[model samples]
Target chain A: MSGQTSAAVAAAAKSVHQDEEELHGLLVPDATDLPLFPLSAVESNFVAYFAPDFTKPSHDHYIYRHPNGLCVVGLAPGHAALRDEGGVKGVDFNVGKSDRSAIKVTGKRKKNAQHFEANTMLCKVSTSVDTYVIRCCVKGSLLEVNEKLVKQPGLLNTAADREGFIAIIMPKPADWLKVKSKFLSREEYSNLRVESL
Target chain B: MVAGSEAEEDLRAFREAVSLVPWHVAKDLISREVCLHCIIRLFGIREPAKGFTSLSPSMFSDIVAELPSTGEGLNGIELGENKDKNDDETNEERHPAPSICSVCFGILQICKVNDAEIPFEKNGVNFLANVIADAVKEEGHEFDSFCVEVSTPPAIPENDLSLLSYINSKYGSESWLQKKPLGNIISLKEALKALVTGPLETKLGVNCSQGTFRIWLTYKEASPLTSCDDKTPVAKRQKTDCNNKNTLVACTTYGLVAENEATEPCVDSGKITMTIPTDGFGNGIAYHESSCLSKSREPCSLSIECYRDAVYFGGRYLKYSRNVSQTCWMIDEERMGVTSVEEIISGCILPFCRGDKSKFHAAGREDIDVRMLGSGRPFLVEIQNARHVPSIMDIKGIEEKINESKSKLVRVKHLKLLGSEAWSLMREGEAEKQKQYAAVVWISRPLEDRDLCTLSSFKDLSIMQKTPIRVLHRRSPLEREKIIHWMKIERISGSSQYFVLHLCTQAGTYIKEFVHGDLGRTNPSIGSILGCRAEILQLDVTDVKMDLF
Candidate 1:
């Protein structure tokens, strides 16, 4: 009986050790150079398009269009709006009588959303020196605006390309094809704006 | 009645069993308006008395009269008056209301039929079986065996417990009981099934077995007697709020009054406190007496339903017409295609099985303009509540019928009846399956020898594809990487710009978008690789690789 008990004890200890080893294997992270916030991951999926000097001069904007035809709109690095002394101090979605952020675009049908032209006013951004009205760079239906910018306006100056994206737009296939030629590719945009940088 | 001698012997045994119940307990239960079936079932005599399950209330009273009453006070004046009224009724069918068993409502009594009772002389197992068999026949199902299921109201079990408590309190210290009043008692549900199953089997010419086919007999108190019912609007309720009130009363009585001997709430709860009735039994009896008096003589309503398990037919189908869709597609109440592959196949098979409805599923679907040629796609048709499960020969007939359809849009192959496991097996291969397609391509520039070599050289080319523009409104926007497993271009004899581009790819890769590039939504497409504009005119699914039929 003592011998049997000792064997049982050894088996129990072996199982516990195996379980711990399996758990440790799961807990150990894989060796990778990928960062927690990997910018390369975003760049690999969405192709960056740029529209410089839209309605007025130096009003540059970038349309990062995903392969699925969803465009993430934001200010390009060469935009005159970001050249203010104190940077962007505040952002307001109430451009007109109605607040653009209050509309809830729900379901795949995207009900209660409005269609906008390429030059439609999206929102207003205030700086220490001047206030600028941002325009929708792509002709499409407006899906959503980044509400996080209201509380943290400094994000637009620090990380405008990432978390500080202005709006997401869904373009119809015909509309996308029609407005596609006006925007320059990433390589073309960088080459054209080389002197501004 | 059909088998005279056997019915007589069964009736004789039933009377002998009734005589065995102690006279005092019988008199007390009869006074409380318990049905004879409820009394026998409460004592757990269902197993031996299974043959004659349907005894009339008058016949039961006649047997109770011969039980040799030992005292003058045991006449049971209420039961005597009910029996006299039962004999005087000209229709011979007693209205179940006044004497309906307080415990079972009227389920065991089987007395209520279309708001009128079955005549007392003919109220037996045979009569009940006729009622159930007629309903089964009306449904037009073909079955060899079935299991009968019985469901009763909550009050039935409550009444059983109440009567048992009365028995324990009144006969706790009697000389006949050497131990507590716990014995081999069958439940109300089991007793009803036993009574009905034997007769049902004889009448329907089928034996009771543990089969997929089921005959469900649901008994409910048509209208419960509750004082609070007047305040609430009547909207056709199945379980009344009065049953919930009774449960609360039973709960408070169990927790406070029967402290040491508290049982669980249902019939199983009674088993825990079988040793003691306690002081709660008195209040329980008083509550039952007042409610039983207030309850109308209306018997519980019975509804019968028949169901057979879902029958599956698995097969492969070929679509010959480009106008035919994989399934029915409607846009704003207008048809998208002439017809669908689902309609032609399901429409042919549904009437044969006589099922309630049919559902069509496939491994994957192609565009309505694309024809499915070569081996065909695997699919399954599930017929819910199928009255007739087709045999192997019947399936062959159906296959021949669908293949010979006049429209000639769809044809089926390898049509076979399959078990339910076929459903899971087809679904398992849907995600990872490979598909091959052949498209007629037209390029802006002439096709050269190097172009053919470049296309065939890549063994596995990975490309980023987004949700196609045609389906973007319905599908979530996401960029997915799919593999073009292999490709081969077949050159036309006289054409310089046109060639048949045949390629095998991952299951969900959009073929048309890969050729024209959907305005560059798909990267490194044929248009980009060839350094020219490309367009696909016609496409056909050459093969789908799944091991299922």
Candidate 2:
């Protein structure tokens, strides 16, 4: 909401000190801890990638920066998708807005079955520039996930309970958030409907 | 001054008294005393002196003149008169006797007795003295000097007591005589008689007479008197004398007796006879000549002589085995255990009839686990020592006998009666010969194709190896060169593989280790070439070529 430069915003996000104004900018209230589950632990095809420049379609994608070098990057699937035709068709059409909205509503119904929970509002956002660069500095513990997630694809179906989500190859962090928020909001809305009293 | 003059005149009278004796007599007495003094100085005798001052001058001169002078012409009349009275009587009967010796008395006699029958020619005196000296020395006496003196018949040879007493007393001090006490007086008489008779007449030679026979019976063989086939006749010449007709016969008889006494029975042909059996089996009886049935006490060196004889059995006649070992296993039952070699030869009746024994010589031995497969190991067996003799025409029979004796475990082919040189060559040629073998190796893991290819390349490669650890305890540690003549993989089974390896090596090369390679103790081993642990399961000797020079 404030007209802050990208550098200022990055600096403010990185600052360890929690000021009232910065806290208000974060979406989830009264939560400082982030919950995380490994991407591999999820059964559903919910995996995402953050591509800084969609037109160039290069694999060099950065998720976050920390004092200790680059902390997250896109894992190149490379020719893995090409070798399996079923993998492409299953996730290709779902990226459209209408299709995204419909999946969000379905995701909301499935939210109760997911396991992980998170408070942080730092999501990877896409930009209008030819190269989309998303910058968010979060606490080191906010991104940690149990290592078993890498080995089992079923574990990734759980909700990520963490302060941040990182998608290095995807553009439009806000749009991604809207889709995720809609899923969560609808799940909450549906639970209210079920409990009339 | 008057008393001094009287003392000087007394001194002059005493000097005159000492000088009245003849100068030579005084000189002789002085020289005798000087000689005694010299002896005393050399040997350090510590006897005290006695006074001779009271003797009259003539008496003193006579006593002094009695001392012997070294000169030939200076004869002392008193010394001549002192000779024992028996000497004067003998001086008339025979040619005048030499003055009697004071030490030996007249016991030592020198008489030349000629006997024509025996073929001995020697001077009597020198021989007698040598015999006496040898006898005395053998008795271990310490006498510094000795001389022989003879008395003629008029003198009672035994009665001259002074010299006899001296000899008797000296004999008492001799160590050998003291240990075994001889009848001193009787020994003196007998010794004198022996000196007169020589060794042939007396069983005890001059040694018994001179009291010098220290060691009796110096040899194991019988006495020469028992050995002689002819007996000498004795004749009584007089009441006091017996005569031997031939002194040469006497001497020769004694010499033969001495020879019999000195020669060892085992080595002496006259005492023992050895007859080695000519049967194919080296077994025979040794007998003493005296009794045909009695076994000889002497151990004899064996010399085996072989003869060929034909054998007939089972409707087929066969030549007896040739060059078999001297005796059958039954004969060697007392010596070594039954070797597989013997069992193989004796298994069949044909072989048993063809040869009594199997003589085996090998370039080297293999572990019992190994089988000699190719061309059989180069071996030679001398069969003629056994009792079964094969004729020259029975070569086919001999061949059949050897083949029939063969067992599944062992077989002898190409059997031949090799020359004596062949045995020598088998023994001596081991250092230069080479052998080939095939071994089955069990590896710890399966061999990759690359490893197999690498192993095959090892053919014809030479390797230097220290003796394998498995045989280290029995063998001396040594480095040997073994050339891989050829190697091929016969088959592969899981982790086990079979290899046929040809090694051109010295006869005794450890073939099994060459295949499995003993923990890299052998260089360029099969295990190392294949880069896996390997061990031998079974081994067979394929070929052995040994050349006889």
Candidate 3:
């Protein structure tokens, strides 16, 4: 926090939606060497964006996913009040200040339930700025969540998929042939923006 | 090139799924109709019955009224609720939906988008097609096929772009959440083609492509390109704040104005508008369906007048009058003759062809005093905006009639229609043919029989001819090499040191210059090569050996 600026100073995210940033030296990773999720994953209303380099005046940003099964969620500057450490009785998500992960793993219920369905509710992530409800985008088993983010939750805003991971899950319903049609390819994802012929 | 992209593999895998898509599986993926035969889906309000769009109007409306209260639009609908009373209630009272064909459904019962949908309009394709069809009929030309060209100002849609910028700043484009809702408006060119091509083809009863005729449609719709805040102060479309969504359209260099400006000179305040056709689009620009469909035969804001493409006729003409030139003679901006070969021929063909303008072309031309003989010279006349060429008209009769005319100045042979491509071939052969000429020579020295014998051995003799003094005022003085293929000399009575010479030479060899040497501009001429000063008193082209017809 002395030589480099991080989101620990919540003001960095206050006007993030305006494209006006007063950022400092930061890492800008490219799309290469990134984890790839199969296109068979469920479709959802949510999308993700990451700003890697704050130094260059302009640069093109592309989409990437954590190969180890972790996703980062940006937060509002005032997320300290919403910190849920432990789950309430009969509640699926942790409701208090107890250490927890953003995604979860459980036994498969059935095979047909795995097709392009939604709201699988995985885990929860509490960053320095905000709290987010993470869900399992595909039918998968949780490997583990990042232990490093427990004591230093600011890692959720800074390192994200690298040192700070939400969870690692192997996709479920072993027959990949049937579920592979759910995910979008990179070109299809890029084509979400209109292009000239 | 960089390393092979993994994104390509992703596209291939997705294409595998695309191949398995069920053609016409549902009336449409768009959920519009609902009824008794309609099976409740895993996550939905009631969808259409299998093989049917809807059971009845009452059943469809009944389900729509109950959907919002159940919070189904924001999330998924609950299934299995109707399991108990299914058979008796649905079968006894409600009527099943009718089975419809894909083609019939598309034409007669295609459901339009609901009121909640924005930026997506219905019948836009039909509106444009009908307008183009009627406008094309108004032109009253018999054409097989045509293409449509739409011109737009490439204006920025500030509101939609602003919405895009708002998404980019928060999500940062590094993840999935921001990728889906980036831009709202499609590229203008793509949208225009999608709207016009299909509708136009259906209306004209022919394919939009591979037709004998070409139709050009221009729409000057978009606002002028917005200039960046640079001081080239030359107004150029500079993409700045490109990552921000508010300037999304500006940041894209693919706008039509930017494309047209790439090769052409930008004059409209350092920007280019769309290409304005010869018949200009009326003053205001057109984009919307209502404004474009009923406006007029011409598209621009100002009313446009339309005209047909030109028709061409190729024939060989015999110019009998030595005083008549190929075209009208103009001296100091004043015409000297009432008519030329071009005018006399145009006067005869134009009345039958219904054309407005005429242009004359020939393989090679002779001097005004030289009359064309033999099979005549290959010529073509391009008749602009020709409305008709009657099938009953006799080409041979026209030729005879022209030959019998009182003037008899220019008579045509092999009068036939020719495509426009032959015009270039006729022009190209002008330099390749061999020409034979009959001339009266005047020699300064006494003519001897031995000197005339020396000229016969000069076969295939090549000479360097510069621009002659007579034409130098109008022609550039560049040197050219021409070959005298062969020359024939005939002896005539030398009463006044005059002799008749029949010479055969190359096309464009400048025969007059070769005999007199043109002040030494032409080397090895009859005067320079024979050591006898020579000049030509009269010259006539006897035979032009190229067959262009």
Candidate 4:
């Protein structure tokens, strides 16, 4: 009789543990498992605009501006760099004389943040075919460059809009207004790239 | 301020009590230039001695002369009217012979009202009451009861200790000392209050109760020598102005040697062994030398201040204009909204209370664009130093004034006067209460029947949210878990993409972020469940589930 009671206790404890697991899944789903289609989490918070063939043909990039003036710079899906075979094999933030990621930007003041022009090189991406240099595309203070792409270059190939975003830049209100009319809005970009996408 | 018959009866009681004191101690203190009221208080006489407050030094001499002297030579000292022949020579040369008291420092001798010197003969309590009543009437306060607050100089407590100790050491074994030990002596503060409270009540036409309305009488020793002496250390002068009651009582009781070193210019080290100088006893004669500097002392400078406690007006307030903020919000010297709910409400109530400044607090606040629509939100306005506390009808008039203003931005309901306790109650409800909001939402995909079923199925659904990017510049970055208690969808008559999404959520839940999901920082959001892009257009608070009025 004692052996039977011990078995019943073990079974009940297992059920309780399973219940906690099910509750955890319902409450805190992992960020990648959020079930959003087509767009990443970062894409949802910003208004996407595109800059196509700037200074060179087929050189395309996307600028995602949040309501606050911070803009995320990255390659659009139809960019010439993403068209390379085997996708991106390596990412580097050391294209310029100083490594962009090594510069420490601290505090609400964004101390040590470097000012960049619209054509400043943010980083370099190497595919199996050839390497391509990505530009900032907007004039602003460069707040941060995503360091995750340097360690996991495959993230750019898989989720470019999410974890593979390039530097975040803060443009002054006057600067944002000057460059704001130059880029295509999301609808305008979609219409232009309907055949290519 | 007291009636004539009552004053006479009080004088009779005071004289009988004075006659009972042993004659030698009275003559000794009288010759020391201690005033009459201080002598009565030093004998530990706790009677209602309202009549003796006006007695000058000579009248006090007459009272002591009637008592038979225990010693023969003391009679000469008692009969003379304050002849300070043996006092300090420098003190005598500085002023006239009729100097302030050695112990009380003219606090019990004269009252200065409205920059005019009124001696005790004019009744200090009566003049004090007149000054206080004039100020109260000038401000036009409406109070039914009041409490008196008294603050005296630190030197006065030190002097009381010195004189009481001198009497105790000189006559420790006398029959009068045995009848009422020196320990039973009333403090100068208590005696002054006893003499003043009755007259003040009569003058103000109010009863004396522990009420919010207060009359403060602050007394400072106005010795010109102390202020002008450039050689005095700044610390010592500051110690004199400290006037902290508990520290004074501690120094009086424990006989701190440090006190003598810091405070006394004429430091006598031998008196350190005295037993809680509060007991009116000292072991050595060194303590008596300090109180002997009685000549040329001026009366304390008296200042009166009247303050009514912070009056709280509490009610539920509704905001109709979306351009009005919950409070005055300023960013980099620029105003965000046209005005605030605080300005509209406090502007009306401040004139009624006549306060120095007013503070506005609410159970919770909405964004500048969100309107408070239903029963509104609980709020309180705390008015500090109010001269007038409004009646119920006055509060109603103030509420109507806010609602009927030309702006039509805010309205109030169930307006009433609340104690300070209501502030804490509203803050307590602010953290734990639930809030319901109605949002005009648009989705990228068409609204299906299953979408409504999917959104309404969440009950007690918990989600983790990082602070939204809009507020991240100021707030600490943290993930907070919030509960969405329930949600429902109401279809618009002619629109599939736009509908009203009603949701009940825990307090502090960001409703706009919960719908759009703040870039997936909030999990299981409305946009996530519908598997499409969702946006909140306009929001209104429908209800706040707190029991407060």
Give the per-residue lDDT digits (tens) of candidate 2, residues A124-184.
Answer: 2221222122222211222222222223212112212111123211223343354332222
Interface RMSD to the true structure, each candidate: 18.6, 37.8, 45.2, 11.4
lDDT, residue B395, model 2: 47
For model 1, name the residue pairs that clash: B97-B297
TM-scores, all models, native as reference: 0.67, 0.30, 0.44, 0.72
Q: Please give the distance, in angstroms, between residue B470's alpha carbon in candidate 2 and its true position after superposition.
A: 3.2
Candidate 2 residue lDDT tens string, B1-549: 114444234333333333332334335323322121111111122212211112112232233345345432223222333222223233233323222121122123222222111111122323443454455444433321222222122112212222222222323344432344322232222333333333322323322223211222111111122232221111111122211222223322221112122222222222111211111222111211122111221111111112222222211111122222222333334533234544444344335334444455565666554555544566555553224333444545555665665333344555544445665566676777777665655555644566556656665688867554444423444568877765666443222333333345556667766655543346677766776555565565555666531
Query: Can you write out model 1's per-residue Cα lDDT over B7-115, one digit (the tens) per residue?
Result: 4455566765665567777877777778777878887676453556444455565656655567433234223222342342432343332366777876777777545
lDDT of each residue in A82-197, candidate 1, tens digit only: 88888999999888656878877765777877788888888888899888888898888887777768897886897677556788888887998998899998889889889987
Worst 10 residues of 2 chain B by lDDT: B296-305
Stretches off by above 4 angstroms in model 1 are: A1-168, A171-197, B2-23, B48-50, B53-57, B68-98, B161-185, B226-287, B292-295
**Which candidate, 1 or 2, would have the higher DockQ against the true structure?**
1
Compare candidates 2 and 3 on TM-score and give the better one.
Answer: 3
lDDT of 3 by residue, A1-197 (tens): 55355553445566543322211000111223222221111112113332211112111122123332222222211222123233111112342332234423222332222222223443455434444554444444333344444565555444332233344334433532343455444355345432421
Please report, as a residue range, the 10-residue window in candidate 3 chain B with the lowest summed lDDT: B270-279
Position A115, candidate 2: lDDT:
20
lDDT, model 1 = 0.73
| Better candidate by DockQ, 1 or 3 | 1
